[model samples]
Target: MTGPTLLADLVDTSQRVGEHAGRRTKIARLADFLRRLSPEEIDIGVSYLAGVTRQGRSGIGYALIRDAQPAANVEVSELTLAEVDATLDQIAGASGRGSIADRTRLLSALFARATTREQEFLARLLLGELRQGALEGLMIEAVAAAADLPAANVRRAAMIAGGIASVASLALAEGAAGLSRFAIALFQPLAPMLAQPADDITDAMARIPMAALEWKLDGARVQVHKSGDDVRVYTRTGNDVTAAAPEIVSAVLRAQAQSLILDGEAIALKPNGAPYAFQDTMRRFGRMLDIEVMRATMPLSVFFFDCLHRDESDLVSTPAATRFEAMTAALPSELLIPRLVTSETSAAQAFYDDALGRGHEGVMVKALDAPYEPGARSATWLKVKRIHTLDLVVLAAEW
Candidate 1:
């Protein structure tokens, strides 16, 4: 049987990945490292290379990490991947009275066992300062290479599966068939589909003629999931903001569909129906305290643009026009964004101007037949904004 993988080995690979400037080289190193890990270690190993601990954040700040550091690192490395993960689990679970003391003791013990290089790696990993060139995209490529599967397959699975670490574990064990099990389910927030920027309305229309144009509000991008009476809201980055935005949850609960996933923006609107500034909207959206007071003071309004899932059907692979139709059938027209489908540039430009006049950022021009490409800045969806140039003098420099 293969022995446990060493933490030092992962640290060494991360160092090498950081040193390499070429993406292909970094991916190769990561893939090779991933292939060496046993099935159980795959998730933990992948999370590390992707610059996160398996236990997520443990409330250990930089000051705590600095104070917990051992005066000297061990001359020889004896830490295994399993050991490190176990220790981190303990740190994360350290709560209640005297939890700070417990966390400090655990961190100090772990640091003491680590070698010089291992200590450096651990410090950076805990503080989220691990700046290896291996980002999520590179790590996804590496997982695909290691598992001998198509990168697109891994990426899609990762999008639905929430994170690459779990998908990596599954892909390495069961390959393509295992990945096929992932689907858009209620309450599991899929990453929002991103758009590429277009120069102007004419350029956007030229790129995607007969496009669907919708107002791009300068507010928080939210994906709302609903199943019967249960409704949840997630930010663009896939954070569950359900508790933070009770108004959004209530709105989703009232939607016509029993099971639905709607993508759109949540903005604080003035009494006259114009949107507040982006920062003002965020202040209301991001707040978790005194929510009822904020909701009363600055009411949030949602405008749905696309429906990814409706009733029992998953429409991620469905065309844009079809998804919008589903959204229309499931949501009240007032809840839906103002949209116009047109091939005429002048007509599209008029819609764009109308959106700007209503205090939105600009407009998004999307191909009617384009399928939703989650987590990608797809060219099929183009954002057209009025650019303003300003002159400024640099009075201060820091570095």
Candidate 2:
């Protein structure tokens, strides 16, 4: 029988993946490494290569990591991937009283067994600084290449599976046939389809002359899942916020469908129906404590724009118009967002103006016949704003 895979092997593969410039070269190296991993190691190995830990954040920050580092690294590599993963599992499960010291002890013990290079990799992985360019997109390509399946097939499976690691595990194990098992289920949140920013309404209309335009409110994006009376809400990043948004849950429970997954925005509205600031909506959406007080003081309203699943049918690959029709049939008109489908640029411009006049951020121009591409900034969907906005990352900030 083959012995357990070494952490050094994964670290070496990650180094090679980072050193390569071409995407094909990166995918080739990643695919080779993925093929060599045993069945039990695929999920953990894939997540690490994709720049995340399987255990998620382990409460080990920079200070704690620094304090936990050994005075000297091990002379030789001895740690296996399973061993490292087990250590992280323990660290993540450590909580409540004496958790910090327990975490520090676990970190120290793990680091003490790792060599110099392995120590660097572990520190970076723990601190979320693992920027080797092996992001989810490239990893998806690698998984496809490794599994000998089309990239689109793997991507679609990843969309429904919520992450590439789990999809990779299945694809590598059972190939295309295993992927067929993935389907939209209640409470399992899929990544929200993203939109590319258009220069203006005219630009958007030019690209998609016949489009479905909906007001883009300055609010929190929420995906609600319901089965019978059980309802759950997830944020854009798939964090469960059901407990924080009881009003949203109650509203979803009242919907006509027995099982449904609806994507929309949640905004805190004034008594007269004007939306509060984005931060205010987020404050209510992100809160876990004093929810009743917050809900009473600043109530949130939801407006559905797309339906992904209804009862036993999966509508992810359904045309936008059909999905909208399904949403309309299942939800009250007040629960759906205001939308207008038209080919005329003049009508589209008027709708855009009205959305801005109502204090929304802008409008989304989506192709009526196009299917939703989850987690993708698809050209089929474009966002038009009155003023162009640029997002910047601060390298250095001085007061």
CA lDDT, every model vs. true structure: 0.89, 0.91
lDDT of 1 by residue, 1-399 (tens): 269999989998999999989989999999999989999899889998888988887988877887787877889989999999999999999989999989999999999999978988888888788899877889999999999999999998887776798699889888998788777778778888899999999889888988999999889999999888988899987899998889888777777888999999999999998888889999999999999999999988998999999998999899999999999888878899999999999999899999988878899999999988777779999998879899999997532
Candidate 2 achieves a global lDDT of: 0.91
Which digits, one per residue and each the tens of the lDDT, describe model 2 over residues 312-397? 88998999999999999998788999999999899999999999988888999999999887777899999988885799998974
How much is the lDDT of residue 398 in candidate 2? Answer: 30
Residue 178 local lDDT, model 2 = 88
52: Cα error in model 1, Å:
2.9
Least well predicted 10-residue stretch by lDDT in candidate 1: 180-189
Top model number, TM-score: 2
* Top-lDDT candidate index: 2
Q: What TM-score does candidate 2 get on C-alpha atoms?
A: 0.86
